[model samples]
Target chain A: MHIIEVTQLQKHFGDFKAVKGIDFFVEQDEVFGFLGPNGAGKTTTINMLTGLARPTAGTIQIAGHDGIREIKKVQRIIGIVPDESNLYDDMSGYENLVFCASLYGIKKQEREKRARQLLKQFTLDDTGSRPFKAYSKGMKRKLTIAAGIIHNPTILFLDEPTTGIDVESARQIRTMIRSLNNQGTTIFLTTHYIEDAERLCDRIGFIVEGRIIKVEETQSLLQEAQREHIVEFKVEHLDEGVIQEFLQSFNQIQVPRISDQTIRISSGRPIELMPYMEFLTSHNSKVLEAKLVHPSLEEVFVHITGVEIDRLKKEKEGKK
Target chain B: MNYRLMAYGNILKKDMQNYYLKPPNLSWGIIFPISWTLMFFLRSGSDVDIKAILPGVMALSILFGTTSMLSVTITFERKSRSFERLLLSPISLNLLMLAKTTGAIIFGIINAFIPVLFASFFVDLGGIQWTLLFSGVVLIAVTSTFLGLFIAVSVNEVFEAQTFSNFFRFPMVFLCGLFIPLEQLPRVLRPLSYLFPLTYGADILKFSVNHQASINRIVSFAILLLYAVGLFLVSTHNIKKRWIY
Candidate 1:
């Protein structure tokens, strides 16, 4: 079942269109990743879907209810972990969770019980009593996620849940996200981290400049670049001129230099090692190592969008 | 059990724990009013009517304690983005505002009571009308709190909210018959005093203290109620319009 369906979603801030007619849907019990660089309207889209912001134009349906008109009903069925860990700073970790539960009209006893369980599950049992302001970035992120799920919403919207935190905390969050998905809660996550989307997302949507460039199942997206093969050869001495001259003899290979002593050659057909090995030997450079590399999701993103991930991030931050 | 009431109770409880119970807030709400009252009493001299001035002191306490605290709390929550959590919940915005206003009113009434208790030591309370005083306190508390919420929702930052609240509050202190009586003020300024809710509050408090039915208590109460309801609606509308991204 499609738990979230958005069509022609648009948001404008004065003359600048933040999100321009974006359309997508999140399936039941699936970890759907909304991937974008910083200023790509990822957060804006999330805000609209969660009813924190009104769209300039569009229809958003979440958990079988209209996101705008039936906002209260939609709010009841979806939990949102915003990009910022914005729980009350003066309240304890446990208090924040219990307080969030209370907003959903959970009984006091049930809320307390659930708060305790969530603290334990999020590895925050020991620190639950401490004020949220005193928590480390990682602990704050964990508590924010825990608080979002305190009501057991049918769908969870995680907006960069693991950004700017320690590696261990990010790992723990990823694990928790998987566990939640396994338990039948639909996850709609927006992230700038390429590896996070590559690993956790069942389907990935590439949103650039407020438009979803593409939305494809993770495997199928990677499969598009699968036909190409990368061959890495480490030699005793590397010369770009010599390697280019040798590669000129073979029209099928495209050599991209990795380092002085290393070069990667990509080809549409499988690269034969013997011809490249012989060519290198004739130049008095011994092949130290050789390996085949598969294209990563990051590479797929670059291939599809023609924008490097790092450059995309820098541009987004600059716009911000 | 009503879920709206439950949500309101929880929101109030959380706000109390997070903002109201802090030492700075407590000191500002409780100690500041007492000190201000003491300063006013010392400066006004012993010959000045203490009974007449006590009601103004109580009104001032309600104004400062409720307005400043509510403004600070609302702006702090908005700046920290914690207010977004409340906005995203299934709870009604009206209930949330009511809960917040109720919390501020409770604090305002408590703060207003301290000076009244202190004044009781110097002046006899036997002749004072208890029912009128109680009604005045409740009405003024609601009016001041809603006014604070109005200022809070009008601005986006904590500093701006505080600045805007002071801009509204300081004028009321001087012109709203708190420090100067309407009859004593210039003819032009007397009309301006009526524009302030604090003027009606002071008038109500004055009638309660003097045990003289000069001003109609019903009119004063009705005007104060209208101010409360009007401010409440305006604040709610502003929050719905400006608070969302």
Candidate 2:
């Protein structure tokens, strides 16, 4: 049975469609990722599933429980690390975790034990007497995650778990999530970190403009990524512009500094590679070292979305 | 039903824990009202009828201390999106509001009665009707909490809520018959005092303290209850409509 399911889910804030008819499912232990650029409705979708946001239309079911009609049952088994930690700055990391555990009706002694265990697992300082305000951003993020799992929920909803965290903290969180999935916990995560998603998620759904434009296994998505064939030539101290002209025959190019008159041109399909190579030979362009590199997840995202993820993000900010 | 009760319990715990964890806020919440009681004691000495001022003081506690705290704190949570986190916790909004409002009730009573300890030394504390005082405390707490709920729902920011509560709190402190009787005000203004829930709250509380359970006091009690319950529902409803998808 599907451990999680969302069908035709939609939500709108006034005139703006925050989520537009998205559908997907997660197995009992799969780490499913909802990947998108900022403002692409990843959070909106997770919010709806977490029962923080009500869907304007369609249905969301968690373990056969309707998110709208049977939310309490759903909440009972889901631990959510919201996009923002929202932990009380006045409370210690230990207090924050134990406090959340208490809300689930865990006894204080049990909560204390669990909190200690979690802090140790997350490599947090055992002396958590200091206020959360004193913690570094990574420390706070780890504390929030610990707070989320204190109840030992069956499914976890993580919203951009590493957005503001450092690379080291992000890696630790990813490792923890993998261990949780191995223990039979289903995780539905949303993140802007394409590489993190590529590395950790079993399947990724690219959300574009409040819609799921694409969803596939990470390896498949990478395989489907638009190819950029690179052609290069080495010369006996020729002008850099001359090689640039040969490289210009292709659409996109990764330009590197030249001391030995060598240029690498990044372009479209393998067919485009032949023309650029032939043009180089015809023009007496001495090609040094050139080869194609597999596209990165970021590049794959840019290819599928028809806009560079970075540029699209900038445009989204401009619109906002 | 258990879920609701538990949710209420959790909400109350959250607020109490928050206040206890913050020393500055805890001290500020208690100081103003306690100071007011000390001032009264210094003037009246042992001869003063402390019970006479209990009703008015209770109203004052709700207004400046409880209502202000509720509005400001809830608005702070709303701004931080913490309220949304709670709402998303799969708990009923009604239960959550009930818990929070109950916290307000508890806070209002403590803030109001914390002065009683200092005043008891100067006045005949044993002779006062504990039942009457308790009634006054309940009314004060319920009224302030509902008013705070309304403010929290209407205001977008904590500062805005503070400003808005001031518009009610400052007037209620004086003209709402908390410290001054409605009879002391002009007849024209006497009718206007009814517009403030604390005025009716103070009136009923004071009358209850005197052991004179008049029909007018009952009317005032009904009016106070209606405002509290009515505003509580309205605010909770609007919050759901405002934030829920």
Which structure among the candidates has the greatest DockQ?
A: 1
Candidate 1 lDDT, tens digit per residue, B192-224? 878889888888888888764334788888999
lDDT of 1 by residue, A195-277 (tens): 79888999999898999999999988777768778787888986777766676876556654345677677777888899888
In candidate 2, list every pair of residues with a backbone clash.
A233-A287, A233-A288, A234-A286, A234-A287, A234-A288
Q: After superposition, how far is residue B27 of candidate 1 from its true place, in Å?
A: 2.9
**lDDT per residue (tens digit) for residues A1-320 in model 2:** 68888889898888999888988887788889887767888888887888767899999889888888898788878999887777777778887777677667676688899988998999986657778889888888888888888889999989878877788988999999999989988889887677778888888888888888887888877765545553444544456566567446543555432334554444554634556556656776655545665667766676555555446456534532
Give the poorly placed runs of model 2, Cα more than 4 Å off.
A226-293, A312-320, B1-11, B20-22, B37-52, B125-127, B210-215
Report the C-alpha displacement of residue A236, candidate 1, in angstroms. Answer: 20
Worst 10 residues of 1 chain B by lDDT: B208-217
lDDT of 2 at B28: 67
Docking class of 1: medium
